[model samples]
Target: MKPHSLTDRPATLNSRYNRLALVSSPRHLALLNKEDADTLVVICDWLLWQSAVTDGWHCVHFETALIDNHAPDPLDMDIMLRANDWVWLDGVDHTLFHGVSLGRQFCSTAQYIVSAYYRMDLALRKLLSEFSCREVTLYDYWVDRYLVSPDLRHLIVATVARDMGVHFDDQLDPVLPGDPALAAAPSTLGAPPTGWHKLAKQCGLALHGYAMTVMVAVQRRLRPRVNRPLVIANWNMVRSFLQSDPADDCQPMVLAPTLPKTLNLLRRFWSANILPCPYPSVGLTQQEREQIAAMVKVYEAHWSEPAEGLEEAMRRFMRASVLTLDNLLPLARQVKSVQAFLRRYRPSRIVVDGVKSPPLSIFLELGKAQGIPADYIWHSPLAPQNIRFDNLGCESRQEALVERCLSWGKFNDMWLERIGAACSSVRVGNPVLAKYTAMKKSGGGRDVALLLQLVPAFSDVRGLYLSQYEFFVEGVRQLNQLGYKRVIFKMHPSMWREEYYEEIARRFELKVEIRKHGRFEDYVREADLVVGPMVSGAMLEVLASGTPMVAYFLKPSTLDSTYFDGLNVQSDISRLGEAVTNNEFLDPAVVLDLYCDSECGQSPAERFWQALSRSPL
Candidate 1:
């Protein structure tokens, strides 16, 4: 089946696919160099008519000179691609061109939006809502336009962020005074010894992915980037979670990153060379710094609820930062720094585990333009109709989006169908799962593990589990009553620091092992039974491990009806104690059918080679 060209498309196309191809042609990058700006007229016209977003856009041409003073906006790029009233200048603007006066003329027939004023200049944004409706904001386009095309990629624009860019909206902690989790970060500024040569060497390693003189895309000082050299660009904890601890020098291997440890040892396997990614500190303009500082107040209102507010607030912040041009100065500088870092690395292929982050969305798009292949390895199963909310109120019943999506379970039927709808996904099993193996049988242990989700800071509220704080706390109490000696409460990484875990464990007198990091596989493997939230990706890992597991849905929604309606999943936590002690929950075999077929019974390298063979690379 041919993709819809610039002219003709179905009135209704799959939104997920629309998300993949924000711009009609990947060749848009090639046209960027053309001397004539008129070439963009065609592109803009095509975007005005053919783009995926239906809300329509108010297109305005920004001066190219802004690139020097302004930042590269991944979000604004989405707006230009999606709007019907799309505007672009015939030539680059040497002077500022406020789109407000132009918006009134073009939007007479259009709906009202609040954020549109932020679209042009931050100074000009206060003049918004003088015209236009309230149902919309300035723009809400996505930043993953070029993320779908691997063949179009020549570079991999990615990052390895340690902090994960999280900050609380409030100055003071309401629950815990100076929450141990809020410990002051050690100053990293100018912390390294002022040695020019070492800094230069670090620069070379980061910029070129190899030694200074090396021109190849995959040359690292520690290892060579050969046969799909894997460059790990972590937006979250993926790097630490997936990468082998340097202390684990039990086996000598090239690059010494863990993926090749077991599977590659079985055969002369083609594993990627792990590049050393250093955390970079780029300077921010004073204006950019101030704008970012003000975000705390703005976000505090957007996310006022407790039980999972911080995560939702963080998510809201990212979406606003990445999806709207409301404030692009900081984001722009960040992108420039990211691009410079990635270009220095010159990576051939990129590997991502778990879901994509909003902050990284721009990098992935940039990678596609450079022709780098990114392998998105999700932690859990991708439901055909995965729930996505408008705001952070994922638990709020009113927050449900009524838009149509592709029918559920269609992707599982065909091999090519998976991730082919938009982004290219590989079923390499869950990286978190790969770390686990059966620890004998459940009979030897009377322990149970309750894997927690985001709450008290922000609610992920997947399926039936809404209040992760209340649900998991009660879950532990119930499991404890069931005569389980150890109800190991796996702490969420966002919630748990090493010190915080010890404090919570001691303070609550909670007789459970509070793990701060990726020891989930170890605990799940050791536990007699594993119970998780209503809809967690970790379910596949538990099910595949041959562990007796149950999905505890508090509200008993569609997921329970589809996978475990009749099965022994405990929809009622009241019955959890009776069911678990009596061995009445789901058997591993019944849940195995949901596993990504190629991922089952395979190592990451084994499954990766199979995926690469089938990939265009």
Candidate 2:
């Protein structure tokens, strides 16, 4: 199937192959046009969306760009809403995989799959709306495979087409050899683990599995002598609950499920007796494995053909799904183990940093089921964003995940009410805010801290033009030009690709210091001014600390920025220096009052611990 040439009439286009060839790279389209393919092209990437405008073939782009003349389609939101609703099968707010509620067992994995599906649906619908024919030709040269698996992609595309009452004549165009110039260019940021890297990962997982098995057995034997409250947290979170005490009595023992090595060091050096709660070493039962095998049929019914036959595609998808499930099995097992732990140990009350984490979420759910009270502390600031509100609303209602929210301040209360997270609230004060307030700013320092966030190229609410690498390199260049003597790059805890950061630094020849460890406030105190993206959670702390900070608003976010209206929110990178130097900031006391509105006499950490101790059963 081929696209009609410019001289060919519309009637000819309707005869055989409809007008579209989906290409992975802009260079691919250039090559196709050079070869006189004369087909209408469709682009899938955000960065490539810009090229479609200038490129010759009247291309249709999936990603909406800043330069797009038309207003965003209202149907885009409708599509998202429909996708969200469809994920919950049979009117149940749960994603089922072979009759098992994957959403209930593994929240993050289900959310990821649903999110990917939604994005794919949006792209397909956007393309179809432009070319509203019942039948269309889609020349598949889309080989940029980093974002999603080919199997899952095929399944999503087929399902969306079926849902929209459309049929596709997929023509498999062989992948063209990449242009050397384009090949070297940074298009996609990350690569999937392969070769020796893959082997090392497998070996590490096996070791962790063995370690978890031993830890679970040891935990059973080392159960607390007397029933007391349990603090489900990491070593750092334990500090918020307990003061520096001489006695390591293991009362309200901390369950640090993440970072066993760190826990070992903390146990040896710290006052608190932090227990390692590794993920349980468990496999699916025979019945469950059979159920997983049945799940392949669902995918088989929906998957579109690639180079392989339908049977081969189904076999590959089945194997992939099973492998994925095997990786996630520990989470399911951990959930069960948590229930058992609650039954046997019978903790009086359970306190968690947040209910979003699997270990903490499981404890929250089980605590409620077993008639035990659970307290939720606001570990980090929750920005009042549209995406977050929808997500919280959906997840909270799906399960009564929250029993009592130990809110940081009035700000948290407002967010809770808005999202309808209908749980009792106690203003326990924010330890993070309290810690920041205690530190005196060492003003007169020449150091500037550039706080980094993990902003991906594609997301449900993403509107950023810059990739993570582009943003960092450009930010450093701007800072370097601004006569900053020493610039410190502070990576977000969640953005743990140190090697990636190092590579970016090396490629750009950036003169900066990288700090991945220690307190965010320590860096804040050391710097004269702090600069970071507006979406960063660290911005809240900077505001609370009354530090001179510039919130870089590169793009529009789903988050309401009315709160930072008076503060420094610079959209233009060129004016960042001006904003930083002038430093006309909001009054620190005002920010503190609004965000950290707690009883002022006691420190937030002390107030938190006291609140936990006196809470009624």
- Maximum-lDDT candidate: 2
Which run of 10 residues does model 2 get worst, by summed lDDT? 1-10
Kindly list the per-residue Cα lDDT of model 2 for residues 209-262, writing each as its tens digit.
566456544654665463356767664555545443312223454554454444
Native-to-model Cα distance after best TM-score fit, residue 221 in candidate 1, in Å: 13
Per-candidate TM vs. native?
Answer: 0.46, 0.67
lDDT for 470 in candidate 2 is 52
Question: Could you list the CA RMSD of all candidates, in the order they appear?
Answer: 21.2, 8.7
lDDT of 1 by residue, 150-256 (tens): 21110010100112221111111011223233221122334464589789866744554333124222334435433433334332224323333221111112222
Q: How well does candidate 1 match the true structure in TM-score terms?
A: 0.46
